[model samples]
Target chain A: MVDVVGSASSLHYAITGRPNCSLSAAGTCCVFLSIATITLIVAFGFFLAGAWVVLPFAGAELGALFWSLRYVCLHAGDYERLTIDHDKVLVEHHTTKQDVRFELNGYWARVILDCQPNGYCRRLALRSHGKEIEFGRFLSSEERLNVGRLLKSRLGGYLS
Target chain B: MATTIPIQDVHNEHHADNHPDHHPTGWMRWVMSTNHKDIGTLYLWFSFGMFLFAGALAMLIRAELFQPGLQFFQPNVFNQLTTMHGLIMIFGAIMPAFVGFANWQIPLMIGAPDMAFPRLNNWSFWLLPMAGLLLIGAFFVPGGAMAGGWTMYPPLFIQGGPSYDMTIFAIHIMGISSIMGSINIITTILNMRAPGMTLMKMPMFVWTWLITAFLLISAMPVLASAVTMLLMDRHFGTSFFNAAGGGDPVMYQHIFWFFGHPEVYIMILPAFGILSTIIPTFSRKPLFGYRSMVYATVVLASLAFIVWAHHMFTVGMPIASQLFFMYATMLIAVPTGVKVFNWTATMWKGSISFETPMLFAIAVVCLFTIGGFSGLVLAIVPVDIQLQDTYYVVAHFHYVLFSGAAMSIMGGIYYWLPKWTGHMYDERLGKIHFWLTAIAFNVTFFPMHFLGLAGMPRRIPDYALQFANFNMIVSLGAFVLGASQLLFLYTVIKCIRSGAVAGNRPWEGAETLEWTLPSPPPYHSFETAPVIK
Candidate 1:
């Protein structure tokens, strides 16, 4: 397997060429629960100290915070992957809820990076025989360009 | 297109992260949304509603003061109205409206897909209504809301009834919400800029917000501490502000002014940002003194800390401390003068357009300067001793807050309404609203300057006969001003419901990344981070 991983120093999204994710494997639900627990416990302590009015507002605030964290956790495992072999190139998209895969014949696949007039990268789309698929929507512009160049070299042999 | 292979397959099992397909529709969408745009809309509408609510209280105040001598409300009730009016306008209306602007514009301007903490953004906004509920709820409680003024100074505040506790709780809740919002703003600005978009390259609105966020983070906590001490004195038998129990009430003023002075900047800095944004766009030129504008904003924010004592100049400090504060407060005019000059220079010799937003921007520059000059006059210790708590102080702040902050908010709404709703507001109606607001506002406030100079104390239900004519004119003007805003409401609703569609780049001179997107931006904006050059 040819593996490529995003460095920790960059934007927090970590991408690995292998099937396994480098993201923290800690359960997302557990993270929110701990945060809520801590917040409520501290707030309850204030309530015990005679600031009784703080309890309900604290609950309301932490409840909102918990809901927000849950959304982040639900989307934490999201990523897109591309695989190339002698005969086919496959694209897989994985979310916390589901996985999707697309298969294309290696000989007819094309990679394109449509850039603005200012030479800034816009989007990365792959086209083949009347079908098109776009990915790398989450990556930065420079990263999208890098990914486009990598895909092009990997799929070079089948050009007419 | 380079052809290297052939492909034919489709899958919907796992959609992309920011795809609009999964956005929750209807009421739950608002309650649980982590999206910045949705939350921004909520903040803006809520604040506008609060503005009207608070403004109604102000109209009643003017009505009571119309003929002087207890016309509408008893003294205590009048106290409640004035206190609630100040609190609601400062915390409820102006602050959140700016936060709303921050929410809608920051991510789009910076090329970030969403705020650094999307969920935190949602939480911060929702807390506002909860806090507002607590405050509004205080009116129904016994003793009918805390009447110790919005400043909540002690001894009197400690003596208030049950509503005082509720107000304290409300303040605490709002302060926490502000801190969360400031954290989100600071984090997003520091960490989420697109490649090549350095701090200096960031939009002026973003820079102003960056500094404002720091102000909120630092100053809000002082307020929290001050209020907490007040709460303790009220409930826990602590003597933080009770002189009879061995505490000094003046210490509370020191702490409160420390927060209060910076809070003034917190309200105006964003207006400065809004004006900076609109002026250059309409002038059709790059802002003059971009680096100096940034430096000037920092200088003003820094000076804000040292000048807290100027507000309490009549509170009897040592002459040395008094002189230090007076000079420091006066020194702020230097940076402020730099900003005003820079804005004028930007407009000079440039292709300037007089759109609705531009008109409001120009009005803010003129009226806010009048307020600032009055502020300089008040900064001198002797003059402040005379004008302090007089209608002149009232007039000065109304010019600053109403004509300055509120007017800029109107400008921002006009400038960005096309981008937000994808429709052009009726310009004729906009101009009419502007004229009505301007005329009525001056008639309402300009007389107050004379009333103050003639020695009329504020926050009182009764005054001598000499101030009656101006009071009547101000009341008449207040009624007209209040009614004129109906035009603003009608204009906004008309534009949102049915108006000409706005194409991308509604304004010809607009230059931000937000202008590069669709007129009504998609639910997921900037899904792929933009590279700013």
Candidate 2:
């Protein structure tokens, strides 16, 4: 789910992370459209047959499928971007409705990899000047750890 | 206890295969494991166990039917045997077996670490054995299992003993389990694909399972509602089905068949997915008409809802309604025919090989079409009126379900057992088992068509002198068919316990993501998602 464009040898490391989805936005819409159409026709047909109980379950199921698909499509545009150079670090996060950016001195930045008991990195963040900003929210645990390692290699441990 | 895996022990994909010993140990490993492979194994084992149990029930039913008059239990017990046989085989055996395939292959095929919700997957699988046990446990209850037919039609259902309530409760549990399982599969398929593994590019098995999950989500709730109403009619004083309370008994049939019809598709669609997967691998060609196959599956699943009334042509329907359902039922053949044609075209003039899986897939395609044709015969209003409760109906479903779904599961097991166990199965033994199963299956269920046409009804313990000969043939075939499954069990066990090393990609034609890894894949796989073009 994460796309790391630069490695330890690159002067500037650029990492991009995006949510997982089986289809593009248009594709998701097409899936939902077909499902919704069939669902309504089936539910309505049963309702006509006096089995009105079927409609609620069908509607609820339709809502669940749509909600899952919509969630995927909504986050489809969201991404996390990080740029690290010799002196400075840049973190940019974008959601469907918001974009946030931050810059910090690479000398003072430190990487935090909080691995859970199962050894997956549950969170990755950068800290400088007594403040911390997290990115890689959309990345898998391994990707998050890899990103953390790349950042740490650029910036040594920060002062406590 | 599971090994305490630390960050330092983890590796990139390059080293993952080097240290492939993260497998847990002890009893709790099975009880608390969240591994997708482990859970898939559990589901398969439970399904096979249920298959044997239900097949034993059929053996007893056949034993009693082997001779003419009252050779075994009385009619009430015979009723229990027939009802429990149908119910257990359908829910406990076939459905769970397909779910087992979905769990094992979906993540591996799609290049994901595991299911989207691993804990939820565990709950879904564990719930099945509980529900199966609850249903089977009813046999030990004072009045025996529910005997109002698996359909549980009203007035007969109205007078059943405590076992009826137990059946109702067990059905509820299974329904919940099925719904949860379907949701997990849907989410996993929709959101867990590799970066470039587009929907159009997914394996046919994935597509079929996805469609089947949707059917489950749509159908199982209706079943829950029907059974809940049945429970209410029995104890809670609601007349949802009670005729004495001004409810129409036929209304229960309407509701039950509505769920029942889709339930049949639920059992078969995954088999179609399996056939699509296996035929192409053995043919050494890309699937012919992949898009059409996907469309056919969708069309078939969509048509399942509108055709429920076809089962009720004998229940005094309006002539117009009868005509509509009959036509709608027949319309299903178009898509089903598309599937059959696609399988055949895929095999046409190709370098085809008959691995055990391929054999089962081929047999499923041919025999299931026969089952479908029989269904068409039954779909005719007048024909079904005579054949309503006859052995022909029983034969039709066994062809569809046993040859179509159950055999595909057997085939699917043979196809994947090598990959799963890291060792090649006994091929000669596998082929022998497949032949025995394929031949005996026909011997058992095929003759019921003639018996049914002769007007010998189903679910009866005794029959007239005229019906005796065919029943005996059916009983003999049934016994052979029942015994052949033992060979299948041994083949699987031997493969798992020890065999020649099956290196990764045991079948050179296999192009899926799973085959790219070790024969038995690492516990954690696709550490960095392999982008599929």
Candidate 3:
């Protein structure tokens, strides 16, 4: 998804992308815990009915669920942000670990959409001077194409 | 646990995926692969292998019953055949086959790179063969396989020797595999969907699997618990089911069916999901009521938990409790009926086609409803008491599992094989396979209904001479049904080896994300997720 700051003609755009997570990190934890809670309650219900053997197995299963979902929640905020301004193009890739940065001279920067033979975009990038930086790594192929077209028309770049 | 890798950079490993040399060659590619498609292929082939083995066991059982006297193995061996056939088909064939479909199609349909936990997916597939070995190995143990039926009821279950422990250990292994697979499915569906692919927007197949995973997570452990108690009774001297030692065997029944009946849905709900997928595609109509289908599936799964005691009706609970279970079991028919109605209505005034997949889909709706009605008939306490261990009970489940779950899996294969293999299966042979299966299946199992009503108990090698005629007819049908599946195998091989090319979208009506990519999609084709409208 792309965001615009300041006036539309100011030529400053923020094209941002993140993992598609409808449930927030907390909500994900809540969902996992909720399922774990219900499963334990049911397992204990059976245990009290003299099926005590169910408790350990249920605990083991929930342990897996809890571990996996916690892993997912920890990375739910992983995101990417690229802003094009008058002089510089700044790309910030933020995961749980680090905020990596990439910069390009805006005047010489060129947007590229590397497409497969079937017209599916394989990668989207911006190249300037002699270096290149790939963006929209998290977006879908079709989404990259849309963002490519948007950036090309505004930046006055030609398709390769 | 966090899914963070370097961005704004090229990892040599990511780029190496394109180099042929970088990919593992030969058996290593399959045995230790993290690829979802490879794992799905392994699961499918493994299940089919198990299917044929179990099917051969069924043939032996039917052959022994062809006449009315002991012809082949002894009565004990006949019991072994029946018990192993039930256990293997349910565990090794039907359940895993659906999981195979889930492994392959779920990621494709949801537009994810792969399962959330790729290595775990590989582990899930590998564990099946080990479990299968123990199962088949049980037959070679000192006293032969457990003959106490697949339910493994105590007292009779306790009488068995070393083979019994092998079977229990096999089940424990399978439970672990199922739980791991379910966790991957649940996490992937809930977290890894492409942007715009919301929960409600997911395909019915995905929705069904999501619900089915929950059922597995909740019920499979209960099964592990029940079997663990049985193990304790055998070696640990805990009388959980030992009536001779201050315990009730009926309690085992209560606990087993608590896991077992949802197991019935665990096997079929995904098939219902398959029907929802195939019918609308063949009918050229949007599903008649998508939201209700989802709600009805949840309702059906919820009902499965309460209605398990219906299986134990003859074991004697209170009259009120019996009535409650009876009504609860019967209540399942309502959501089941809704699913059938929606499938029918989806075809109403639409461009319906009778492709092989469609043929199987239509047959499943009609035949599974027949099975559901039989279940309703048995839901009454009086009728259940009459039909409890009879061939009628056998007839009912075969109708659902064989015709319903098994057939849906076959249809789904036909529906998706073109996409998987990049070639259309021989339409001629596929149709023949379907007709032979549908016709011969009825010929084999239909008469069992009559044999059952006339009081021929199941799991017996011989019956009274009065039931001889129907037994002969049933045997003939089982043989023909068994033979037809070989044609199915040939058709698949022939399609994969040499058939007309199928471009990306083989079926014009297919609108899922998988179809949008190339047929036989690339190894990393889904690295960029597809957005739903």
Against the unseen true structure, what C-alpha lDDT does each candidate score?
Answer: 0.82, 0.84, 0.87
In model 2, the runs with Cα more than 4 Å from the true position are: A3-14, A24-52, A55-153, A156-160, B1-24
Query: Candidate 1 A-chain TM?
Result: 0.63
Q: TM-score order of candidates, best first?
A: 3, 2, 1
lDDT of each residue in A1-160, candidate 1, tens digit only: 1235443232222243321111132543554454456445645554564444445655655565455445454665567776665556666666777776667765677886766565556666667765667766566567667777766765543211
Compose the digit string of candidate 1's lDDT tens values, residues B389-469. 999999999999999999999999999999999999999999999989988989999899999999999889889999999
Off by over 4 Å in 1: A1-137, A140-160, B1-18
Error of 1 at B68 (Å): 2.1
Best by DockQ, which number? 3
RMSD over all Cα atoms, model 2: 6.0
* Total colliding residue pairs, candidate 2: 0
Top model by lDDT, which number? 3
Q: Tens digits of per-residue lDDT for model 3 on B1-533?
A: 32333233423222413421245779889988988888889999999999999999999998999998899999999999999999999999999999999988999999888898999999998999999999999999898998889999998988789999999999999999999999999888887787799888999999999999999998998899888999999999899999889888999999899999999999999999899999998898999899999999999989988998999888888999999999888889889888999999999998998999999999999999888889898999999999989999999999999999999999999999998999999999999999999999999888888988998898888889999999999999999999999999999999999899999998877777889877777766577666678
- TM-score of each model's chain B: 0.97, 0.96, 0.97
True contacts kept of each: 0.15, 0.19, 0.43
Model 3 spans > 4 angstroms off: A1-16, A26-30, A81-93, A97-136, A141-160, B1-25
TM-scores for candidates 1 onward, in order: 0.82, 0.87, 0.91
Candidate 3's DockQ is 0.33
Best by TM-score: 3
Winner of 2 and 3 under DockQ: 3
